[model samples]
Target: MRSTAHTDPVLTQSGCSSTAVRALQISIAADKALVAEVRHTVRTALESWGASVIADDMAVVASELASNALKHAGSEASVRLRLSEGQALLEVDDSSMQRPVARRVGAEVEEGRGLFLVQALAAEWGWRYREDGGKTVWASLPVPAGSAA
Candidate 1:
């Protein structure tokens, strides 16, 4: 969380850390509108980093993670973005300690493919569980040099 009285950017979490070139964080409700905001924030931030080519894919990743958090982890999830060292990372922190499982094409569902979509778009994706029980799912993609346009 950031504590800005007026003009100071608090950029570090107690134990949460990252190697992103630049980053942003937001607390979102378990609502679709809030999820949309996450999507937009990611697109704009990546665009600022000259990685606009991946904006749409980034937005899709955000929506997938946010929706999964709402559906499986409740409404207390936070979204974070990190753009560092030629890479863009998206993370969703949620109260649920349950690790996400990758669903097979017909594992036993009619339509459940959130994680699958993420895997397809992200260059790499993974998760880590906090000592206190919360979990963070992160995905990363390369940032192209001429992506901004």
Candidate 2:
């Protein structure tokens, strides 16, 4: 969290932003304590940008992806949010290249539901292996109607 905030910087964690595409990013340690911080940060930024309608959805997506990285990958992760077209694109990058699988669990089960929640909340979601040997999972949620970027 101490790394420079580029408006929120880094070629790795943040792509910065211009008038054309609004973006903010933060690099997080594997510590579980920071997941809640990520959620709050994302929501606050969206509200400030007039995208509060999707803040909850993006926050949920952010926490789930970040948790997945922490639990399974056991490494630091980066969370980035951007306004693309009319959707809020949230991406989480971690050191693991292993793709996430959305498992089907019984209703009685409590675990393995993170991606399931993400799928239901996001407009669309997927993961890609990066050239740097890590992987990034991303979700795009629709912006609230009439919200400015």
Candidate 3:
């Protein structure tokens, strides 16, 4: 559960407060066994950011994204958390170019509803290709009003 956090000087220089932007990046293994670790990491990060109000939702979103990377990309991934101005941005980087698609799942199905759950939980979600090779799927979850930013 290694993670790193730092202040973005650029944002601060641009008039945002020092605590306005905080970020954490954690490396995720390609193995599905690590899904629980990833969820734990997300929970800890959100708690440390004083945004525990959204921890459960963010944790589920992170798990889904990490599982997708392991199932589809079959390669190591990285999870990044960016918290700023009452919003939390969760991103998972994986070595796959295949865009994520939301598939409809019947009640009896036991699989294939990762993106659907993400869409239903996240305030906004999308993906983009990385120049080096791979893609990053991201979700934005707003911190509940009144939670410390």
Candidate 4:
């Protein structure tokens, strides 16, 4: 695991370390209501970047990852978004050091499907131990050609 995220903007766990054309980040206390705010904020940022093509997907991925951090990590969680040339990167970090697992659940099940949703929507997703003492769960989605990433 990378000891610390780069200072330019604590980013990655993914190999796409290309400079971000645009970026934003925030940290919120563990609260269910705040999850919606994170979603909206991330969506707005994408829209401003002219990346409406992936707005909804980015919102859902952002909220789901935020929810996981709040519910599982049980501490303040931070989210970072980086739009590069070919992809939009979303990362959620929490104080807990434990890694996340993605599992398949039956349709009848109503819970434990957050990671599943992410897997379905994200082109690539994974987690890494943060040098500071937590784990950052990240996902990358393709940005269509001719659109700002």
TM-score of 2: 0.84
lDDT of each: 0.77, 0.83, 0.88, 0.84
Q: Note each model's CA RMSD in angstroms.
A: 6.2, 5.2, 2.0, 6.4
Number of colliding residue pairs in each model: 4, 1, 0, 0
Residue-by-residue lDDT tens digits, candidate 1, 118-140:
99999999999988888999999
Predicted structure with the largest lDDT when compared to the true one: 3
The positional error of residue 55 in candidate 3, measured at the CA in angstroms, is 0.6
Q: After superposition, how far is residue 10 of candidate 4 from its true place, in Å?
A: 16
> What TM-score, computed on C-alpha atoms, does each candidate reach?
0.78, 0.84, 0.89, 0.83
Number of the top candidate by TM-score? 3
Residue 108 in candidate 4, Cα distance off native in Å: 3.9
lDDT of each residue in 2-119, candidate 2, tens digit only: 3223332224334564343567888988897899989888888788777888888889889898889888889889998887556788899999978899999999997799999999
Q: Is candidate 1 or candidate 2 better by TM-score?
A: 2
Candidate ranking under lDDT, highest first, comes to 3, 4, 2, 1
Error of 1 at 95 (Å): 0.4
Instruction: For candidate 3, write residues 1-149 as lDDT tens digits.
Output: 46787756334555755555778888876779889988998888789878999898999999999999989999888999888878999999999999999988899999999898999999999999999999999999998777945
Candidate 1: which stretches are off by over 4 Å? Answer: 1-20, 105-110, 146-149
Ten consecutive residues with minimal summed lDDT in candidate 4? 1-10
